[model samples]
Target: MSLRPLTKFGYLGRTYKFFNGETLYPFGYGLNYTRFKYSMVSSSHALQLKFGRLQHCRDLTYEDGTARPPRPTVVVDDITCGKELDFEVDIQVQNVGNVDGADIVIIYSKPLVGIKETHIKQVFGFQRVFLKAGENKTLKFTFIACKSLMVVDKTVYKVLPSMENMIVIGDEELFLPVQINIASCQN
Candidate 1:
């Protein structure tokens, strides 16, 4: 199918999602004379955040005020971002090459399978650091799980519990698996 019809999703021409899909070059595709190595400095479970079951919208009628069969929808205003969902990931980037240079690190989040019509991946956070040859720097990326981790299903914002959230870095796809938990929930 032509991606032209997915105007709502914008152009599928760019590699905003799937990393392993057939493509010449995708997001974070860049060339550099110097090479960098990325290693996780934080705990693998550092991304633990809270999620809760979604509640359906109370307005049962259609937008035009016509009564119809009830459908699952989220109340846009009712959605709240709690502190329980804030987390951070720390990664150390070392310039392994013999030349000093600056590199931009793009953090991409691969959506959990439970969400439908989801992007193959989405940008979470990014950082650019200039490191001397053989120098290494630690970069901290903060994420409000409710924001970057949220997905709109049927036009309503919601977060679902999943252990499949994947974070990829740079031109190379480094898989970082994270578990999302439900805690101190707000109804």
Candidate 2:
């Protein structure tokens, strides 16, 4: 009796779609051989700073040299929105002695105070970096916020009933938050 079926594999269909140009996707794409490292050089306090430490997920554990979930991660240093803050992030990327590689750096922000949930605001920028074998690259960033734009209270930005008295005295306090993301070729 024949142990194999007569049906073709799914790979064939995917391959055709990739090369046909009829589809928007490319075949054998998204494959990489090199790796990348990321490091912050500095940022402008006028830009608003945001960053965090890298850590593994708690739900994942290794018993006998096994892998786990929630791999390498970048945590955000929560900051109050609308408030001005000055900080810097330094990062370095070294080729793991394999081959050439690249990386993409992303930064984000959120509202710190008077927000029900911490929602992602906007993307700072995308940095495309390349590295050579055994070579390391560094990056620095500075961040800041505009008070006029960040103050969520209508009184601070405009005029509110409750803020009338405070407006007369002066401007109130506000805080703005920012986030960071680092992705390597390996990930």
Candidate 3:
């Protein structure tokens, strides 16, 4: 006799709905009593703010077990092909409501090219920033472009560069879009 593996459900479970027309208040859903606005700031370095330091900022090996040198952090507009780079986005969130409240900031990333079997979008990081009425705060999110290419092969995990990476930020009503190019590393 043969038996099937058990299935999971809920937020991070495999049976969760992540697309349109499926359901309301999908994953990472939160309600706020106040209104907030988000805007991207122009800066030389993608990661300009120094409020907190990144815990993991280092080079990673490829699937073939080859070591690559660490790439320098540069402005988002200057990223080119063949360069392993780390970048960040600075978003300003303002509480335009009349009362004090908190807003949960969620960050998600998806690969333009599908990697056999993987989630449509995965949460990489998130932060909950509390703001008083008419208060504005800037949150910086830094990410290594290549680190999003993780894949599971058999029982071992490997990192492979994707053609393009799509980053999304969950705000009040707007979803911020940021694209990263990783074509050069695929060759």
Candidate 4:
């Protein structure tokens, strides 16, 4: 039998996707020859922002961990949408290893409010950087709501009045939701 069939997860198999119900460690999680430390250099406070009504032409379908069927994820078009509510965050990465090495810095985030029960943190940004044995660098990451947060249809953006009015950044979860009172998306 294949490794998938030998494990106890059935067809789901033993993979990073099903790390929760099982006791297996997360992928890439183990002792490394070199150690990397992460710290919060700075982050913007969350705020409550308002947006116009969001319009969806068709229902998108795809594999979503939260939903047995599927869920909505932003595409490239809406991901590029810009607004004043967007913010930036800085993270300090230090290579505490005896030898030089490179590491990829990943940025994860979640809405103070859940996005259709997709509560797990989703990646928004990442950058590959190299460092010396004792080198430390500050990386800048932009918190684009359209890309990382928020839901949209075909055009325009929408905000849920009942949703949590705060944006939570990973690491410290600097929650400061910007409430946006959207009238409607009529066009």
Put down candidate 2 lDDT per residue, 35-73, tens digits, no spaces.
544433433223323333332211112233444333222
In angstroms, give how far residue 21 of model 4 lies from its true place.
1.8
Native RMSD of candidate 3 (Å): 10.8
Runs of candidate 1 exceeding 4 Å displacement? 1-15, 18-21, 46-77, 154-163, 183-187
TM-score ranking, best first = 1, 3, 4, 2
Q: In model 4, which runs have C-alpha deviations exceeding 4 angstroms?
A: 1-19, 27-31, 51-80, 111-116, 151-187
Scored by TM-score, the top model is 1
| TM-scores, all models, native as reference | 0.69, 0.34, 0.57, 0.55
Evaluated with lDDT, which candidate comes out highest?
1
For model 3, the stretches where C-alpha displacement exceeds 4 angstroms are 1-21, 42-84, 113-115, 149-157, 171-187
Question: What does the lDDT read for residue 80 in candidate 2?
Answer: 41
> What does candidate 1's lDDT look like per residue over 1-187, in tens digits?
5321254555454345533336777767778889999988766554443335544333222323444443233333455656665678898999999999999989877655534444566787899999999999999997876567554443344544333467777764477766654444433
- TM-score, candidate 2, is 0.34
Query: Candidate 2, 4: how far from true, in Å?
Result: 50
For each predicted model, how many residue pairs clash, with residues at least 3 apart or on different chains?
Answer: 1, 26, 0, 17
Candidate 4: tens digits of C-alpha lDDT, residues 59-100:
232223434322223333532356654677677888999988
Model 3 residue pairs with clashes: none
Residue 38 C-alpha lDDT in model 4 = 78
